[model samples]
Target: MGMGMGLGLGSNMQQNNSKEWVKDASDAQKGVNEILSFEEYVALAEKRPCLECRPSCKYIKDIFEYFGKSPRGDYNLFIKESANSTAVYGQQRVYEHIYQNILNFTEEGFNNKFILLVGPNGSAKTSIVRKLMEGAEEYSKCDNGALYSFSWIFPIESYIKGTLGFERRGEQKESCSSQTYAYLEDREISSILSSELRDHPLLLIPASKRQQMIDTWLKAFPSELETVRKSYLYYGDISKRNRMIYDALLQSYQGNLAEVLKHIRVERFAISKRYSVGAVTIEPQLHVDLRIQQITMDRRLATLPPSLQSLNLFSVQGENAMANRGILEFSDLLKRPLDAFKYLIMTMESRTINLQGILTELDIFFIGSSNEIHLSAFKQHPDYYSFRGRINFIKVPYLLNAEEEVKIYNDQIASLKSKMNFEPHALECLCLWAVMTRLRPALAKNYKDKKLGELVTTLNPLEKALLYSNEFLPARLDSEEKKLLKVSIQDVIREFENENLYEGKFGISPREIKQIIYEISSKGLMVTFVDILDFLNKFIDRKNEHDFLNIAPQGDYANPVRFIELLKDYQLEIFDHELRDSLNLVDDRSYEGYLIRYVQNITSLIKGEKIKSQITGRYEDIDHFFVKEFENNIKLKESPEIFRSHMMTTLGAYSLDHPNKKIVYTEVFTDLVKTLKESFREEQKKVIVNIAKNLVFYLSEVEDPEHKRSSSLSEEGRKEIEIVLEKLQGKYRYSQAGALTLARYLIKEKY
Candidate 1:
C-alpha cells in the first residue's frame, strides 16, 4: 500500500512538471514571434511613435530615472535596477554636465560633436562610459527600449521564380500571400542578407512616403512628433547594400513598393557590448575603424536573382559599422597618432565615415577618453583648433570628498571582512589621508566675503576634506562663521572648477588605496587604524615613485607626510571618544540632551520669558547659574550675553531654514559639541589614562598566560577592563584581537 501511495505522488509531480514545461515553451514561442512584419511594425509605430524613432540621447535618458537634484546642484541620474546596477559615485558634476548635453542633443537635434571625457589616470573616465553602455544594453532587452532593424530575405530559387514572379511568366502564381517571408524556415530560404549598419527598418520606405506616414501616425503625439522628426529615422536612408537590393526588387516588381517590401524582414534587435551588436569599444591600435568588402563572390549568394547578382554588392564591415544606432567609445583616444584618427574631424561633423570614397552614414553617439597628459599634448598640436569645435569636454576628477572616498574602500572592506577583522575607522583613516593630499589651500582674497574668505584661507587639508564631505565644521569657527562657511561650501568646491589645475586632479587615487587595503588584509590578522597609517607612511617614503607625494606643500595642503600626522591626531581624538564611551562616562545622546536643555534655558533668558522645566513642572526664571556653568564647561570665548545672542541667532536661522523639522541640537551646534567633548576629555583625563593602562595590562596578560597569574589588577579593575573589551567588540564591530591592538596603541601613543 505504501509503494502504491509513493507512485501516485510521483506521477502527480511528473504531471505538474510537464504542465510547467509546456507553459515555459509557450512563453518562449511568444518571444520568438515578437519579430514583426513591416506592416505590423508600422502599426506598432502608430501606437508608440516616440519610442519607434527615439534618438540615442533620449534612449539613454529613458534608461536612467531622474532622482531629483542634489544639494550641490548636480542632477542625480538614479541607478535603477534595470540599468545593470553599475554605480558611479562622487562624480556629480560630470554626470550633470553629461545630462545637460543629453538634453541639448534631444532638444536641439543632433549636436554633431563627440563627448570627450578627460581626466587624470585612475579616475573613472572609462567606468562612466561603460556604465552608460551597459545601461543601454540592458534597456534594449525591454519592450519599451526595443530596437528594430531590417534584413533582405531571398526565398529558394523555385519559390522566387514561381511565387515572387522573378521569372516574369505570362501569369504570376502566389503560393504565399503573406506580406513578408520573415517567418520562413531556414531550410526554405536561400539567403538572409543582414546589414552590418543595422539600418532602421522604416528606411525601406521611400523618404517622402515614410515622412507622410510617420506624420499621420505621430499627429496623436504632437509633442513627440518634433523630436521624432529630428531623429535619424526622418533623415537617414538605407545602407548602400540595402539600397541596392531595394532598388533591384523595385525594378523587378515594376515599381510595386509593396512587392519590394514583401522581401524585407523587420526584426527586433538588442544592443550588446558582448556581441558588438551596437555598443563597441575601440582600443588604441593603428588600424582603420571602417572598411568594406564585396560580397558577390560568396557561394551563399550564388542562387541570387540575376538583377542583384549583376551588381557589385559591397558589405560595410568594421567597428564604426558595428556601433551603428548606439554608442562607440575610443579608449585613450589621444594615445593614437594624430594622423590615425584625423578622419574624426570631418566624421564627427558630417555623421558619416568615408570608406574608400564611399560614405557610410552613421547614427552613433561617439565617446572618447584621454588622460590629462595625453590631452595636454594633444592641445599643443596645431590641429587642436580644427577638432576643438567638434568635441565637448567633460572632466572626470578624482573624488575630493572623504566620505565618498570611504565608500570605495568600504566596498573593498566588505569582501575582506570575512577573511579578517577591521577596527573601527581603519578605512576611514586611509580615505581621510588620501583626500587631504588632494585639497588645495584656499586664497583669502579670492572670496567675495572678506571675513568668510579669511576663514577659508585658514582651512587646513583635513578641515577642507571634512567641509567637502559635509561631515564636520571647522572647530575654530564660531556659530555664525561656521554658518557662513557651511553656506559657501558649494562655492568653495567650485572655486577652482574652471581652472586647469583643480583640487581633485592631483589626489592619491582610490586604486592605490585599494591596493594598500588588500596588502594589509593579506596578512590574515586584525586590521587596525594604526596599521593603515603605518602602511601609508612607509608608502609615502618612496617619494620619487609617487608623483603626488613629491608635490610641494601649499600652506597645509599637498604634504602627504604631514597629512599622515594629522590623521594620527584625528585617530587619537576618535580613540579618546571611543574609550570614554566604553567607560560610560558621557554618551553622545546624553550630552546632546544636556546641550539642548542649556540652549533652551539661554533662549528663554535672552527673550526675558519664563521656562517650564520638565523636572520642576513649574514656570520659573531662566536658570542663569546652570547656563553659566554649562558655558564655562565649554570655555565660551565670548561674553555670556554675546554668546547667548549668537546662540539665539543660530536657533532662529535654523528654525527658518528647516521649517516644521525637529531640531537636531548636536548637528546644529557642531562647534559647541566639539568644545564640550574636549572639555569632558580634559576633566576626566586622569581616569581615562588609568583605564587605558588597565586595558593594556589586561590584554598583555591575556596574550602571555604566565603573566596573567602574577598580574596586579584589582577585581574591580579586571571587571572594568573586561566590560570595555566586550563593549568595543559588540558595539564597534571590533574583534578581540583588534580591540587588544587598539588598547596597546592608545596606551603607547594616544594616552
Candidate 2:
C-alpha cells in the first residue's frame, strides 16, 4: 500500500503532538544511585512522599480510595476519555475553536453549542484538528513531553512551610541497638534518658503535647515499655538543653506526616489537568461507552438515527436532550443525502444519553458528511426542518490543474527513464490524456460534508498511473470517439501488414499514440499549424499483434524433419544484437546506427530446451571460456577493422565513429595490405578479391568449428604456428573469417 494507501488514506500519516505523552519513559533504573549520612538519609527520604503509597495515590490512600479511577482503589489517576486535544491549523486558530467548543460543555464562558470547519477539502481542516493534538512538538518548547505525576513534585519543601501541619514528638528508642527503633525496656529507657532528663528536665515534656504524653505513656511506660513500646525513636529532650531538642524533633515529625498527605493529593492534580496540545486521548473504555449507545448498523447506511417521527427524544422535553454527548462521527458522510440533515444537527447540539438507568449527560461533538444526496428531502416535506447550522462543509476539489498535471507526469517520466528508456513526449502524452479525462471520477469520490476533531489526506500520488495502465485504458472506454479512432488506425495497420510494414514509412499501432504525440510536439512533421483530427482512429489498433509469422514451422530448420522442405533453400536472419552484427540494411536508430535485428524472423514454440539453453544452463562455466577466447582471438588476431566493426554492433553502437572503434583500429592494424584488402566491399570489387585475405585471417584464429571461436595462440605457440601460417598464406595476406554477410545470414538458424 505504499505507506499511507491501504487504510483509506496514505500511510505517511503525520505524527500527532501528544505522542510524547505515551512514549516510553527513559530507563531510570539503570542510572545513578546515591547514599547519605544518617541524618541526611532521613531528610532525603522525607522528600519523596510518593514512596509512601503507589500509582493510584502518592501519599494519603484514604483520599485516593474516595476519588481515584483505578480498579486497585489506591491510584487516583483518571484513565478515562475526554475530547481535550488542542489542534492549531497552521496558526489559523482552528483547533482553538474546537477546544473552545468542547470546553463550553463544562466551561460556561463561551457556551458554543456547535463548532464547525467550513472549507475546501485538502485545505487542512482535519490536519488542523490533528495538529492541535499531535502537532509539531518543537514549538511546544517542552522537551520531555506532557508529564503527569500523581505524586508531589517537592514534598520536603511543602512540609517545612507549615503548609502541612503536625505537632509533638513521640517516645524514643532506649536500647543501645544499631537500628533506629530499638526496644524501649524500662532498664534501657532509664539508661538512655538519664543523661537528658537530669540535664534538661523541661525537655521531658513539651508544653503543648505534654499533658497527653503524661496520660498516655508515663503511667504505663515504666511497666509495659518492653512489650508495647519495644520499638520507638526519641527525638526530644536528650540533654541538659535537650528540652529544646525534644520540642523541635516532635514538631518536625508532625510536619513530615502532614507533608506526606499533601504530596499524595498534589500528585493527583487531575482535578486541574489541562491540555498543552490539541489532542486529548480517551481510552478504549470510552470508545466502548459510545458504541453501547449507538443502534445496530445495516449495510446501506449503518441504519438511521433512531428518531424521525419520534423526534421529541432530542429536545429539552426528552430525557436525553441533544445538549450532552461525547461525539458525532461523520462516517461515510458523503454517502448520505444533503436534505437528510436533521439527525446530524441534533448530534451537534449538546446532548445526553440514557443508558442502563443512568441519565448520562455527555457533551456530544458531531461530524456529518455526504456527497450530493438527499437535497430534495428538505423541500419534499414542509415539516422537514432537521438541518440547521450544524453541518460544516469541506469540499474535495477536482484533480490537478494543467500545470500540476504536467509536473506529475514529468516526475513519473523522469523516474522511469533512468531505469527503462522512453522518449520524453511518449510518456508525457499518455499521462496528460489521463489527467484531462480519466482521473475525474477518483477526485469526485472523496467529497463529503462534515467536520472532525482532525482530518487527513489519504490519496496517493501514483494511483493515476497504475489505474490508467492496468484498468481504465484497456477496459473502461467504449466511447464513439475511441471506436472511430480504432477503426481508422486498424485499416492503416492492415495495409502495412500486407506489405510487411514498408521500409521508409512508419508502422502504425496503438502504441503510436504516444510516439505520434511526441513527433507532433517535437515538430517532426512540422505540423505546428495543423490539428490532429480523430487521433485515435489515425493510429493502429492497440489490441492486435502483427500476424505474419503466426504460421511458421517451429524448430531448428537444420533438422530436416523440423524444416518444411519447400522452404529449405530460403535464407533467414537474427535480431538480438548480442547474437548478430549492427549494420542493419536500414539505418533506423538514435542517429548512432541500426540493428541487423532478427532476419527471417525465426519465430518458434519450444516445449523443450536446446543448445542456447544448454550453454545458458552452464553459462557460468561456458562464460569463463567464452571471455578468454574472445579476448585472445576476437579482440587480438582479427584485423583492427573487423574487431572494431563486430564489437561495435554487439554493444548496440550504430556508428563506426564510436571512439572505442577508433582505439581498436589504432592499436591492431598490422599491415596496410591486409587492412586495405578487408575494406574492399562488394561495391568496390564485384569479384570479391582477396576474399581469401579475410577468410584466412578469420579461419587462422578459429580454434572451434561448431562455433567460430576466437583463440589467440599463446606467445610460445604463436611463434611456432606463425612460421607455418605465414608460409602457407604469404606475408600481408589472408582474409577475416565468419563473413559478416554469412554470419548474419546463418545465425537466423539458431534463434
Candidate 3:
C-alpha cells in the first residue's frame, strides 16, 4: 500500500512539473528577440510616460531615486542595497557635488565637461564609477529606462527589387503589404548595418523636422517637452557613419521620408559593461581610445544597394564611440601620459571627438578618477589651467565616520563571517581606530566663539569619534555645550577641508584593514577584538612602510599608538556593559520605566498635586522619598526645586519640537541616563565580578579536560554562568572561545 501511494505521488509530481516547464518555455519565448519598428518605438514611448528623451547626464541622474535625507541631512541615493555589499557610505557630499554638476550640465543643454573624482588612494573612486555603470546597465533593462537605436536593413536583392521600384522597367510587379522591413527574417535580408556608436533612432529624422514632430507628440505632456528640448534629441546630431547612411537613404528615396523610415529598424538595446556597449572604462594607456575603420569593402557589405555602396562609408569602433550615448569612465586618467588624453580638452568642450578626419558628435557623461598625488603633480604642469577649466574636480574622501566605516568592513568580510567565528565589537574596534587616524584635532583658534572652541579643543580622539558617529556626546560637556557641538558637527568636519592636507587624505584605508582582517582569520582561531588590536599594534610598529603613519603626531590625530589606547579603553567600556547585561538580574527597560515614574512623581510634587500611579491606577500624593532616592542615585548636583524646573523646561522644549510623539526620556536626557547607567554598574559590580570569575573558571575547565571542575561555584552560580555564556554566544555573536577570551580579559583588566 505504501509503494502504491508513493507511485501515485510521483505521477502527480511529474504532471505538475510538466505544466511548469511548459509555462516557463512559453514565458521565455515571449521575452526573447523583441524588435520594434520606428512606429512601434514611438508608440511604446508614448505609452510609457517616463520614457522621455534625455541627455546622458539627466538620464544617469534619473536612474538613482532620492531615498530622502540621512540623519546627517545628506541626500541618500539608496545605492547600498545591503550590509553585505560594498557601496558608497558616508560620501553623500561627493554625490551631492556630482548631482549638482549633472544638474548644471543638463540645464546648459548638454554635458560638455569631464567630472574628475579626485581623492587619495583606495578611496572608492573606482568603486563609485563602477556602481554608476552597474546602475546604468540595470536601468536599461527597465521599461522606464528603455533605450532605442536603429540599424540599416537592406532587403535581399530579389525582395527589394520587387518593392522599392528598383527593379528593371520590364520586370514583373509584386505587391508588398508590410509598411516596415523591421521584422524581416534573416533569409529575406542581404545585410544589416548597425552603428557601434548606438545612435538614437530619432537622429534619422532631419534635424530641422525632428524637434517639431517631437514637440507635437509631447504637446499633451507639456512637462515632458521641456525635458525633450534639453536632451540630445533636440541638440545632438548623428554619428559620422550614421549620417552617411541616413543621407544616402534619403537621396535614394527622393525625399520620401516615410519610404526612408520603412527600412529603419528601431530595436531596444541594453547597456552592458561586459560588451562595452554604453559603459566603457578606459584604462591608463598610451594608445588612443577613439578610432575609425573603413567598412565599405568588407564582404558583409557586398550586398548593399548601389546608392550606399557608392559612398565611402566608415565604421567608428572605439571606447569613445561605444560609450557615445551613455557614460565613459577614464580610470586613473592622470596615470596616462599628457598626450594620450590631451584631445579630451577639445572633446569635452565641443561634445565631439575627431576620429581621423570624421567628427562624431557624442552624447556622453564623461567621468574620470585620479589620486590627489597625481592631480597635484598635474597641477604643477604648464597646461593644468587649460585642462582645469574643462574638468570639474569632485573630491571623494575616505569615510571619517566610524559607524559608516564599520559598514564597509562588514560588507567586505561578510563572506568570511560564515567560515570563521567573529567576536562582537571586533570590527567596531578596527573601524574606530581607522577613523580616529583620519581625524584632525579641533583647533581652538579655528573657531570664532572662544567658549565653543575651548569645549571642542578638550575632546580626545575617542570622544571625537563618538561625537562624529552621533553615538554620544562627551560626558564632560554641559547640556548647552553638547547642543553647540551637535550643531557645529558639519563645521568641525570641514575644519581642514580647504587645506591641501585634509583629514581623510591620510589614513589607514578600508583596503588595508581588510588585509589585516584576512591575516587574523588565517590563523584558524576565533577572531576577537584582541586579535585586531594586536595586529594593528604590529602594523604601527612597521610604520615606515606607510607614509601616513610616519607623519608627526598632532594632539590625538596622527598618533596611531594613542588611537590604539583609545580603542582599548572604549572596548573595555563595551565589555563592562556586555558583562553586566549578561547577568540578567534586571531588565534594561525597567530602568527607563523607573526614570519615567520618578519624573512623574517629581513633577506632581513640584505642583503640589496628586499624581496618577501607573502601577495602582489611582491618584496619590507625590512620592517625595522615591524621587529623592532616584535623584541621589543619579548624583544630581542641583537643589530639588532647580532640578525640577530644569526637567520641566527640557520636557517642554522636547514636546514643542516633537508634538504628538512618544517621548524617549533616554534620548532627551542622555547625560542623565549616562549617570544612571554608571550608578547601576557600580551597584552591580560585585555580582558582575562573580559572574565573570565563574565564566572564566568554566571556560578553563572546558578548555582543559584534565582540569577539575571548580567546587567553589554554587549550583545557582553554575546555572547563571551557563546562561551568561549562552547569552554571550547567542545575543552577542561570540563563539565559545571568543567569550572565554573576553571573559579572561575583562577579569584580569576590567574587573
Against the unseen true structure, what C-alpha lDDT does each candidate score? 0.79, 0.27, 0.78
Model 2's alpha-carbon lDDT is 0.27
Candidate 1 C-alpha lDDT tens digits along 1-751: 9999999999999999999999999885464336666766777887887788676777766766424455765434433223354456788778878877877777745547788999888888888888788777767877787888877778886765454433223434344444466655677688888877988887877888888978987788775678768866787788888888889988988998878877767888888898898899999987888889998897767877777888888988889899988899999999999998888888767767788788788888889899999999999999999989888999988998777777666656887878877778887888888888778888877778899888888888888888888657877666667778888888899888888998888878878878888899997667788888888878888787679888888767888877888888888778767768888876678777888889879878777899987898998888888888898888777678877888878878999999999998898886787788888888988988788777766876787887735776778999998898898889887887887787787778867
The stretch of ten residues in a row with the least summed lDDT in candidate 2 is 594-603
> Can you tell me which runs of candidate 2 are displaced by over 4 Å?
1-329, 334-347, 351-369, 373-384, 404-751
* C-alpha positional error of residue 319 in candidate 1 after TM-score superposition, expressed in Å: 0.5
**Which candidate has the highest lDDT of all?**
1
lDDT of candidate 1 at residue 141, scale 0 to 100: 74
lDDT of 2 by residue, 423-509 (tens): 212333333332322121122222231211011112121222233222211112222222332333323212222232121111122
Question: What are the per-residue Cα lDDT tens digits for candidate 3 across 175-251?
Answer: 33236777667788888888778888777767678788777777787755776687668867887877887788889
2 against 3, candidate with superior TM-score: 3
Model 3 residue 588 CA deviation (Å) reads 2.8
Q: What RMSD, rounded to one decimal, does every model reach? A: 4.2, 30.2, 4.8
The clash count for each model shown is 0, 74, 0
Q: Estimate each model's TM-score.
A: 0.91, 0.24, 0.88
Candidate 3: C-alpha RMSD to true structure equals 4.8
After superposition, the stretches of candidate 1 with alpha carbons farther than 4 Å from their true spots are 1-33, 66-86, 160-178, 220-223, 613-618, 639-642, 656-664, 707-709
Q: Best TM-score goes to which candidate? A: 1
